[model samples]
Target: MKTNRSMIRTALAACGFGVVAMTGAHAADTISVVTFGGAYEAAAKKAWFEPFTAKTGDQFATESYDGGLAKLQAMEQAKNPTWDLIDLETNDAINACDEGLLEKFDKKTLGNTSDFLPGSISECAVAAMVWSTVYAYDTSKLKTAPTTIGDFFDLKKYPGKRGMRKSPKVAMEWALIADGVAPQDVYKTLATPAGVDRAFRKLDTIKPNIVWWEAGAQAPQLLADGAVVMTQAYNGRIDDAVHKDKKPFKVVWDAQVYDYEWWGVPAGAKHGDAARKFIVASTTPQAYADLSKYIAYAPPRKDAIPQIDKARLNDLPTAPANFKRPLQIDAAFWADNADAINKRFQNWLAQ
Candidate 1:
């Protein structure tokens, strides 16, 4: 389903920040926020939530989850959503908005639509950061570094167990790219029956050697513990490992699949007004830029780029040298086909 950008802009303009004024009495209510916890949640607390609390005297109750629509769907069906704001992946944001599980946001609250990245704004969500799925290996373990997506699958030359997430999304896309499908043509090819089979066939080559991980924190740990020579992981997780934990991991940016992480309010949020204000405060250009101080992800606002430290720019997914062969995740394609693809993935895993 297409996002109605024009409708969002028009509705937001008419409403303005009047909603903030109307909800002033509820300003100090504690907002419950959820995210994929770990280094990301820590970074957000310093850059977004704490600052908002200090400025507004509002507070936050935080929780973490491995992302999906099931919990949100259950909450909406029960008419008692506990989360005020959520950190959503692009595909989840699209599906949740379409299903009316999220509250419609007013873009006018953010000011200047053109300052944000394209596809950053949706009817029910606002883009929070730009992150990527990348592969990394322990630099000390490998005598020679692997530079491309294809290298991740070459067992003869770089022999070791492989680490992969226990999901099909990025794994399928990476398989197609390694099999020589051009980055731009991945979704187009994956849309066909033969293309899906081709991806699985490629995956079958290394299936026996795969050590599957289900969480963001596990990917880097797999590499650190020498469980796998290389693993597919979130770029920030690898960066955190190398910088924070002093692990010897090196990220391979080739054929990286980049996408946005969004802020979405659940439809029946207990602190909806407070949540809306927090979104606006935390997404200001300065706040967005400040997040990179604690994590490697890039902010979604174009204006935020200038405020970021120049030294940190090279590590971001949007940086020129790192982004050369990037493939943007196809949220619409996943929104349309995730169920069918996931079912096939599960069966493939069992067999």
Candidate 2:
């Protein structure tokens, strides 16, 4: 995953506006695409997917995946890419692109993607929604709230079994941030040995308190079951979960790490142009605004945020105040550093 500039340029040159003809008919055929089938997925379908289909007379099938990357890899290897387009977590998108498993994006078809936050849109992928890894706690259990990564690590003062994303990216940054690197310097700190070692050491102190969660939905479920009093979770999932399950989970979006879920077409896809059109359709201001309200992930499209509820809008990771303390993830940075960093992260986790 070490994407050097020369390598990136070479890859881009190799892809050259990669567009392909439609499968059957000319200019009148119904296009096909796939997406995750979740509650939020269903929201996306109702708000945009089905509407796109109806408007264009194209049919789409939304599929659910508990493990999207593994499934995408298997599909790619099998040479049976059933999905034309699929959604991915930030790290997963990077992982797939580095392997050349996703097609280079159709930038010409995208009208105002620059309206998205800088760097959120990539050559092989485009972020569909942005969310946070915030300190979500049961307000009823704690007297005072923890405000920063340092406070979260001080289990003695804010003692509880804590849960975090089992993924390498944010979890490691959080560990480093808690170990004394400032929020702004977290990645710079991880780019070195001593900084990374200090992070693992800090993590070791609470390793026993860790309840590792792999699913986006599992974080809040664990909190509700009292498996952990506090956990780093997706703001939308936690908010919906606590409200639905009658739990006291309240999220304070201070010093949160923002991550995005992306849309990428598989490499050698049969329906590339149609997929790109679908991506443009789905990520538009109108569609993204409606989807954000339901999914709770903020749209990277600047105009999309204003269209959402002003009150709930402030709770999002993209909120102006939240952005002051927040760190915008560098996907390319992670795309390049993933292999080494993840291996070291795994080694630490194994210990």
Candidate 3:
């Protein structure tokens, strides 16, 4: 409705409500949320955050994923936790949920959860955003080309350079997927010794030729520099890089692994109930769609899809074609085995 982007969030009076100007005697709760960077973060601040603060007079503070996790751990360990809510990816959310560090969040606080995908919503968590990792390559470098994770291992066939996230989640899953374990069975196969070994053995095939990307932002840079011909990158990063950097690239969503994010309320948080309320307020259908414009990922709310047009909306991680060869993460497995698998994955990387 507002054409001027900068004035999009200005507080209003009377017939229209303004950000942080709502009336009533509600307590001014300090709501803290942890999230990742890029468009998703931008969207949250615009659609949900600024308005929530305006409407409820609540203060919202958001921190990044890694920084937030460490801060959360530190806060609880000190017995004077600071954060009200945290947004975490699948494994980290599972870790906190399993460790009893989170409190049960009822519907009133987070609003209706019925519109979300069944597995995306949880007892202590709610889906914040959704996205995936896919095989992306600069067209200029591909001689034979790649269509899937399995192709990443065939250096001898496609044989240029490769880039992949050094993190355990993508590394482990890609290793198994490339090794011929179908997308559905990646988590199941990861729990066994043979399965673990299988992923590594497959990863070893590319270690010599691989560039390790430490940040989600690094993938686009690596591609732009021609550091690696093919990489497993978050879909948004590749999309932005192609659009902004003018690099020639394509996302082969086939054999893609869908990743999810969740918002968790910290147990013993002083203002946790209010924290839940803010999350729901910020994650509405319009907000989720707005977030995707900045982040290029899908939102957790299933209804958000219709907000975008048929052409643009089809770019999402959960789009039918993308989901056809989707890889579902095993949050329980990651929660149970993170410590061990992390160590093993690190050690193998050293070799």
Candidate 4:
């Protein structure tokens, strides 16, 4: 009987594979990873986690959390960190890094930082994928197609409940875009108090008819169940729903808020070396390309672009036509403004 470790060693021998030696013997056996835990985690498990575990003979465990630095902060403060690696959104990554809750990587450990897309190789994180928030409509239900961000707010023209995330992040940006702010000017306009007020004013128009969703999965379900005629969704989610389930959903790329998801190590992670090794193994060009097989989020490595399925190209935010009007989410702006606007958003919702 061959054990999994024996099998892996045998396979490595057969392939002449040179595994990176892990440090920190106390934490070598296993490392815990934290992520949002849904389809994204499913894709990661298949594309990276399983392979990394098999190759390194290291145990991999996963935990799920809605993203926030508070948990990471608590763990760091208590000297009881649970997660070795965290899959973080750009804003959270910036906030966490700024607070020194995340560990900066040795650029060598993750391979060539230059190979990653601009702004993706940050001080404490490396991007996992390029993703976008775009609104989708079930094609069968729409009498006339909505082409632009503005159409998402035009109730008289496309009458029905609209689904949006309960948070102000993407919704506020969309509101400004709908109110005739140019894509380039979105964050600049949003930096002003008047701009914030204007965005909320725009949202006020759709508030009564809005069905607010709290999770990524809820967006597609909202459209499928007829709870929303249109919903703000992670572009990949809508693409999967349309492709996998044969749903007639169509994504509106106009004013889409595109950003990167990053992989980072918590400041006091026990399995530091293993976590770094896992990240390096998982971000190789092949791994990046393979990720597209399980999810629509495009890889951050430019070289991995051509390796993905050609049929799925148009659905990706990187595709030339789809990117025509995308607003690359300004992480710095969100880091600075999130708390303030969030307070205002809650108060407005109460009103």
Ranked candidates (TM-score, high to low)? 1, 4, 3, 2
Taking the tens digit of each residue's C-alpha lDDT, what string does model 1 give over 1-351? 136855665675587634344345255788899998888998999999888876666888999887899999999999999899999999999999999999999999988778888889999999889999999999999999999999999999899999999989999999999999999999999999999999999999999989999878888999999999999999988999989999988999999999999999999899898899888988888998999998999998888898988989999999999999999999999999999999999999999
Clashes of 1: 0
lDDT of 3 by residue, 135-217 (tens): 79878777655676677778778877888877777688878877788878888888899998888888778889988876667
- Worst 10-residue lDDT window, candidate 1: 17-26
Clashes by residue pair, model 2: none
Kindly list the per-residue Cα lDDT of model 2 for residues 140-233, writing each as its tens digit.
8889887777777887998889988786777777777777677889778877888777777888888889898876678877887788978988
Against the true structure, what is each candidate's TM-score? Answer: 0.92, 0.82, 0.85, 0.91
Instruction: Give each model's whole-structure lDDT.
Output: 0.91, 0.74, 0.75, 0.87
As a whole number from 0 to 100, the lDDT of residue 280 in candidate 3 is 75
| Candidates sorted by lDDT, best first | 1, 4, 3, 2
Model 4's TM-score against the true structure: 0.91
Give the distance in Å from residue 123's predicted Cα in candidate 4 to where it truly belongs.
Answer: 1.1
lDDT for model 3: 0.75
- Which segments of model 4 are wrong by more than 4 Å? 1-28
Residue 276 of model 4: what lDDT?
85
Q: What is the C-alpha RMSD, rounded to one decimal, of candidate 2?
A: 11.1
Best-matching candidate per lDDT: 1
Cα lDDT tens digits for candidate 4, 61-127: 9887767788899998998988899999999999999999999887777656676888878889888
